[model samples]
Target: MTSVLALTAATAQADAFNRIASFPTHLNNAEANAESSAEIISATADGMTLVYSDSPLEVIGLIDITDPANPKAKGNIAVGGEPTAVSVIGNTAFVGVNTSESYTAPSGMIKAFDLATMTETAVCDLGGQPDSTAAAPDGSFIAVAIENERDEDLGDGRTGQLPGGFLVTVDVVDGSLDCDTVNVIDVTGIAEISPEDPEPEFVDINAAGEIVLTMQENNHMVVATKDGVINHFSAGQVDLENIDATDERGALVFTESQPNRLREPDAVQWIDDNHFAIANEGDMDGGSRGWTIFNKDGTEVYENGTGFEKAIIAAGHYPDKRSDSKGVEPEGMEFGIFNDTPMAFILAERSSIVGVYDLTDPSAPVLAQLLPSGVGPEGAVAIPGRNLFVTANEVDLIEDGGVRSHVMIYELTDAAASYPQLTSAGTDELIGWGAISGMSAGAGSTVYAVNDSFYGYQPTIFTIDTATTPATITDATVVTRGGHPAQKLDMEGVYFDGEGFWIASEGRTDRMIPHGLYHVDMDGNIDAEIPLPAELLAVERRFGFEGITRVGDTLWMAVQREWADDPENHVKLVAYNLETEQWGAVHYQKADPDTGWVGLSEIVAHGDYVYVIERDNQIGGAAVTKKIYRIAAADMVAAPLGDDLPVVSKEEVRDLIPDLTSLNGYVVDKIEGLAIMEDGTAWISTDNDGVDDSSGETYFWSPGKF
Candidate 1:
């Protein structure tokens, strides 16, 4: 008889052991999850899987589920696109790719291959981009989710945009039919829930072909038929009985709360046919905890426990879990057979471990064991034929210009057993050099990693390698890029088009200013540095440039204004086209001495618009508004030519720039960096400057139509 352990009792949190106990003094700079929807999930034979890539480019990884409690390292695959999800049927695996570069084509690629042989078969370019995908039950078709964005520029310098996400069915078997393979199924109503707009976090298709589960990440649940469009439903509104429930059909609806104060929703999972569970793990300060179990009809049958309420009862201590638990950010999850029974595989996202839990009882999940080898586990899948589970552990951080990642595999004796022993499937590392930030892989052992400097001052880049071992930097070498000493510059944000690396730089230290653009060649050589206007540079010196994004051949920058005594002074976004040498601006009202202008800071471009981050004045007793601004390229088409730029008094301009005041209802903080998304939204990061309520805060905003 298979061992039956009580899997629903909360594991005793015994003093909260540090997962990184060996690697003390590890860097712990936490940035908010700017793009939540693009988590790529792939599994290898070693039971390893790729979760979410931290960098701006593509990341692929693996996890070990052979022993659900002991997931270990395999390696990472660095592809050139913004990879969102992975699907495998038999030996052939399909990868979904996305691109966030504004100037580049909005294209996606599907890489199909024989995972068993590790051989490349075909590369299909999906002109219609995709975010995540699920394989059909019979393996004849694939349900791919694509997102189309619309920007609505608010005349007041702030713009808003909404996501129009849809699903496409792609044929996996016939590579020739891949060109005209997609069949569109609109998911706008299911995804567009918020007045501001809603983004789909993750979408999965069941093996039985009965239901497709799409986790919106922030809001409700979206359920669709195999060939039917997804029908949106709130987690609070899920009617379980309306559909047939099974690990194959109903197992995708699990919920886990965010561990941070940002209040993003938790990861979700499905327990069984009659029961589904949502983990309300709560955000920072142990905000909330409990499992909400619902029947087929969507009624809350019971809540087993609250956050620390249950943890305290089991182990004791006010549990402090952030959204991405440093131990594991709960993002990717899977429920499959274990030892002839169903088990839940949860990747403690960001955490280097895959958790095996007995979810037979939906109300309370018993922690079977914590697998300890994977890094950044996002998604996991179990293969019954081989009795193996695989996870993608994305580890794309460059400490000293080296890449370190592995595709780990784990083998299990029983596919339906709750927690069996996990064994390795031989780790395969995708070795290469340069600072890796993100990764993805294509057919024929093609691996990619987004490369960027750890310091905020390096050129954004992506490096390609085909090594079967984890990537690493063996020596400390001086590198030159973009006509500048790579060692001397500060840079962040990187993307990889199929041809070359698409990089962006925050440019400077100051907040309210504009910076120049620089491009790096494939051989790590700096080809050009498009300088900003001397006059603009002079004015920006008082402020500082933030985000530099590529939208096709043109680059966009958000120009945040400095503070002044008359709070009404404002901020602006400046767009510079690399192709046409044209520039434009989207201006916001200077804060009324009574109201604050809190100028825009970090700005990134997406498609046709630029999104800018706004921060309040740094000085206390000033405007308190904290918002992001969205500017369109159309409105900012005509810019002041640099050749005919005007000369200005630096001393006077600097003095006036600092004296600007802001309006009420806004916080006056030093808003710093920016990043753009493929879906036209923008991300902003602020500087603390040793101030209160101002450290480590990130914001997301989008541009509207011109």
Candidate 2:
């Protein structure tokens, strides 16, 4: 059964999660230059404030969500140690601090703070490293998972090290912790694997005062009643079929199988007194790549095998680079009753998506929605009273000039779902597409786009139908050479010729991929290959052709950046005559960068002029130039190679900053595709870097009939 949450605008009008606001973690950091992250979030009883643990900064950051549409940063509080988890009861926040010196001597504490005064109230020594914390639903006590946490490099990265983990329960009276009432419960010899090293990963309590814990490395589950009586069971394993089990292969193939794969669960949440759910984020031996529901007595109720993964692939959010490690990596989970319906929110850490399931019937839950999160969603909190949902994304890519760690807010409303602007849901077969570099208009409303070097082993041209809202990919044709999947090709651009497509393969000479052009038939069979002339090859750089377009008998290629022989702030618009068999060039002056370098990304020819996408390499707020400029055909006079190329004048057609941020996200760096239809309607798209270290959000829309 394909568990696809096929949500469209018309069908999602009842109640859906729609993103309303995003707050970057850096806004609360005092250093401004230091990296910070938002992880393990908890909300106040009023549901107006959010607090998250920031281990990198050794602090706990706060955000005011009174107005869910405009989240305000409340700054950070120094915790003096690594804060592992946080939970709130009334006006006080309970934080678990890890101060472990070594695996053999793990030590930590539980720090309680008063929200009104913003001061520490009390602390209880846990005597072990704490990983997760949860407050009793009735506010009577708090539970902490004391994970001694074995070192992966020691003993082959398995468990069974010294000082096994345990659980700590503390009495809470009027939002204040009673340090003397702390009770430690030993959870040893519970699982079949590494029974001596029960590394407790997560904890949650139900309304009946029963605490459930997950021993991730041990592949075990434990349930402790309020009176300290415990029952334990093994998480067990499952048979996985139709999965991509290899890593970094530059392709997505789901034909492999892994039988008896262990479900080393990470985050567990009690849905009711008798049932709960676990995110199977395996640690030592296995990760099943999906979630499972279990009865309180360890009876397997429902296991969503590869169905959840298939849905993520259909939505174009699969993480191909993590195929071998843990596909999608479902790491966090939260359960709540919203609008009288029990809902489960499962967080896929690598894919940066939140899967919302309606648990009206726990035996067979319905996949309702898939919410787009930040780069890595590690924790989630549901504010059902306010009809709101919050997620803490833990990835901060500041060093790579990418978006910082963010906390995203979503509201449950009757409005239609706004995310997933592009999907492969209605296609004949499952299609995965990302890193869209260049595009060309085909017959009618169809457009053809090519993936870049990210999928070097499976170069494919995708056919997108723009007539549908949130355009859908209808077909994908694998680009072939000698009747086999092409290799060593970094296809950046595609142009629909009279018979087939003229493709521009951006080359890296260091990797032996020469800068060249290839003509492929409609069936994706290469018919001809043309190498750069001697004059251009001598001056070529790794940043070669980015886009290609055909104008009558000539083909124009937009050089991405300045070559060895080009002037500063200018790149060549090289032209090759199909009939004359000659090569020439013209320089197109680009904008100077405010921080990083700027260059051209795409080129297209219309009636009387040609349009090109010019952008800066900087992302988010640091970006300066992301626009479309046009050069009149009369000024595109190609000069012979080895001679001074005449520079062409440009006219600004559109400023794309608004379009890039229209979806309420930080601006992406790669605006690499442009397609104009026969009716003069213009369309543009941004490359998602194949969801590798990316938010996996692709924007494909028009700038109002340019």
Candidate 3:
């Protein structure tokens, strides 16, 4: 018994990196609805403090991570220019400040500040716009990539403009920068793509003091020492297959190919003294949609090809809107060795995920995990000594009432992975899924769910296995009409009735998506579509059926909000009889608005009650109502449509605020899915809004037996 107990305890403590906390960038600004950002990040030598560059706010922000699980905002420092990147070494912070007046007259400065006093100590004129800043492992020097980035509006955004960019190295002596020892290396006439304009994108230094850089727009890379450039080569091209190459189609079809696709690498990080990796976040021409490891002598050690993109797809993070340009857009990366395991973290900008790979074998890296990022992760830093990783998400959608820019902290601990709470990792075919709106429990551990209008062109029904950790999406079936992929559907609910599924679609008349219900067989063939009745359609104001479920011979639909004729704060729980083909509804008393309007998102029938999710549209701190309410099954009597409907009373089942905040993230707005099983266990989920102006975090968790 002792040995068995010891083994169980050992297994319970895992060796993985899990997110501990997130600090919003606007916290340091003291401004509400401020347009702030956290772009590139760095940390002090002890890893107790963090510094990030906020370009739009023109400041360098600081955070005290003395307690990694509870990061506190230290405040922001004015840099007097657009701070593009920052690197911290001991007590000094070397920041690359871009003061470029125009594309042709590009100029910037690399400034060093005392972290304690928060004052500028030394500065060096970079002679061009700087992109990435990195410090040598031994803290001997700092390297800045002088990008002098091109103006996309001018000359069709192609490179080869005048005043080519170069690399600058500043000596760091006694933990302080020495502006006099700054060495500039001319990196021109190297790459075959644009030899005249070599715009360096990212830089990294190894323990051996060798600095490596990537010229993204030029599709090139360079290796240099303090004295001069040693070797230069093309970032190279890849023939990508099985990729979704078309955008605005609202579907994930990986049948297209981009032949000889250029790998416009964006971020570079050294794995060791001999090898390094680059994130191919292409500009101008191409983005390989993955990462690559290369030897110091220009040999391709490992080419990710489409592997990383496919993994992102499996995690339900495929950004269909960016399919034509760069899918997911692998942009930032960091490498570290923790607990004898060498790992490389690659950031997917558009999908808002960090793909963690075990680089034990650089030539054959194993993708270990995909952690959810806040949104638009632009830069990252890995502190192996402290067993921590950090990401700076650059996009702040405050004006749009979206989540603010956040610097997420992940700590390597003896705890299991807590993110990606839902995935399609082991499915038969690669299934891209998101916007999980409504769900219904089936036999045993199976649950059926549907995607909303965000993927309107490809209506789909997903089968979920609740028995697995992260709740696996086992299969996906696209709803079809006459053997063609059904388009213009905003599927909000799905129900499995032993042999087939009942689907509810939430529509918008302006966008041409209809509000209706679908009877789909097991094979995804639509047997019939049930449109709203004349009276219901006349009163509809785009807030249509959000969920559907069955009881005896009746199909109950939860109208999202109050219609034109319904009383204030009362939504319709419409019912349809399969045998009688009649439409009726009962008024559901919803809560009054605290910040935004409250409405029902999902409905499920089981045992002796009918469950519904009532939530407010507000997110973060403004969110007030995100609850599960139940009404006795006997009270679900339906009155005829367009009449004075009887109101149904409800009792609160569970308060979902604590559940949504359990992940240590900002409270998401939509709580659209709820499913109760035979064992009385309940499952809840949220919609990610198709990752558009959203963090793209789909929370799927169980509230236990209800």
Give each prediction's root-mean-square deviation over alpha carbons: 24.2, 3.2, 3.2
Q: What is the C-alpha lDDT of each candidate?
A: 0.40, 0.89, 0.88
Q: Pick the candidate with the highest TM-score.
A: 2
Q: Tell me model 2's lDDT, rounded to 2 decimals.
A: 0.89
Maximum-lDDT candidate: 2
TM-score against truth, every candidate = 0.42, 0.97, 0.96
lDDT of 3: 0.88
User: What ranges in model 2 sit over 4 Å off?
Assistant: 1-14
Best-to-worst ranking by lDDT: 2, 3, 1
lDDT, residue 14, candidate 3: 65
Candidate 2: pairs in clash: none
Please provide, for model 3 over 1-706, each residue's C-alpha lDDT reduced to its tens digit, 9 standing for 90 to 100. 0111111112122677777788888888888567899999999888999999999889999999999999998988999899999999897899999999998899999998999999998888888999989999888999999998888888888887878899999999877778889789999988898899889999999999999999999999899999989999998999999899999988778899999989999999999999999999999998999999999999999999999999888777888899999998999998889889999999999999999999999999998877888889998888888889999999987777768899999888877777777888877778889888889898999988988888877888898998877678998888999998787788888888898999998888989988888999998999999888889888888888889999899999999999999889999999999999999989999999977689999999988899999999888777889998999999999999877899999999888887777667778899999988989988888999888877788888876777
